[model samples]
Target: MNAVLRVAALGLGQLVAIGLLLFVSAGTVDYWQAWLFLAVFAVTAWLPSIYLQITNPVVLQRRMKSGPVAEGRTVQKIVMLGLYGSLVAICVVGGLDHRFGWSAVPAALCVIGSALAGAGLVVTVLVAIQNTYASTTVRVEAGQHVVSTGLYGLVRHPMYTGNVLILVGLPLAVGSFWALAFVMPGIAVLATRIHDEEKLLGDELDGYREYTQKVRSRLIPYMW
Candidate 1:
């Protein structure tokens, strides 16, 4: 099967699973804003993959393993998924609570979280446009060349940075402390992956060391 087909299958499966669970068990819905936020998010997250599958299957097919390609370490991948799950759980539970007229602390987190998640997703789309992914392992193609302009000019791994933003934003949007638990571990995993990924690029990828020198920051602006 092609990359587009594979991605479509996965995306569809996730949608179906989540939809069924929410409908059959949870039977809950958030505010209209939450639904709108989720719609935008789902589209942004999957649209790029769909585009890449059609436009650049080579990047999608070149995986580190016979599975989905992640930009960083495998452990980080699991952690990110966990964090995202927490975000969803928070949304579902919080939405339920809100519907039941339960009180929540720090009301501002809802608005802030939505903004962060939405903004982070926009960044994610931009990174998707700039970076290429493969099926086996992380790599940039021979002619793909490192990007040192735009967002890359400041951070070596803007995608990781964006990922963190969304990871934290999801739980914040739902206003749940339980969902926030994954942030620290997620950050730790991302840090390790960034370090290891840079080391790998320094060794395997051409001119990546110099790129790092020029960028000066891994995930932040003007700082390490």
Candidate 2:
């Protein structure tokens, strides 16, 4: 398929995935927060993908790639699936929490979380803009290099950082306090993935070791 078509298909697939996640979690199809989640994800994910498609189709296509790389990285993929499970858990738990009134998440808190989620989405777009080799997988691409500017100047893995915010914010935003508990597994998985990614980059990608020395933090600023 063409680049535009590919991006469209990806967007549609994500929307379906989000819907299914919420349905399985909540056991209903008319949930408001689920709709909100769909809208938020659509806006956050597609805007950047569209921009990348227009301004940098090659990079956009690279981000869309999905195939197995070399061996010895199966653990990361499994953990990544576990992370995705956590996300589905977040969706499901959020739905169940909403349905069963398990969480008294205030409307104000939900609004605030939504705002943070939106901001995190914007950061995701920035990550794509700054880092050309920002693939979903953990392997260094052919033309990958150190991106030490913008958010990368602050953290070595800004994409993952933004994702954490996205996943964390989604639960509260969707009125899922119990689901918030499930977020830790996803956080642990992502945190470990960052270490693995950095190790690979440090070993393979040029200037990454020096970049790590300068950045000194992986996810959090001045803490991690």
Report each candidate's C-alpha RMSD, comma-separated, in the order given. Answer: 4.4, 2.3
What are the per-residue Cα lDDT tens digits for candidate 2 across 1-224? 37777787788888898788777767877777667767877787876786688789877766666433422498677777777788778887787787788889877888777777777888877887787777767787676677899998999888788888888898887887888887788889888888777788889999988887899989989999
Q: How accurate locally, in lDDT, is each candidate?
A: 0.62, 0.78
What clash pairs does model 2 have? 25-92
Candidate 1's clash total is 10
Pick the lDDT winner. Answer: 2
> Which regions of candidate 1 deviate over 4 angstroms?
1-9, 17-27, 30-34, 59-108, 133-144
lDDT of 1 at 197: 67
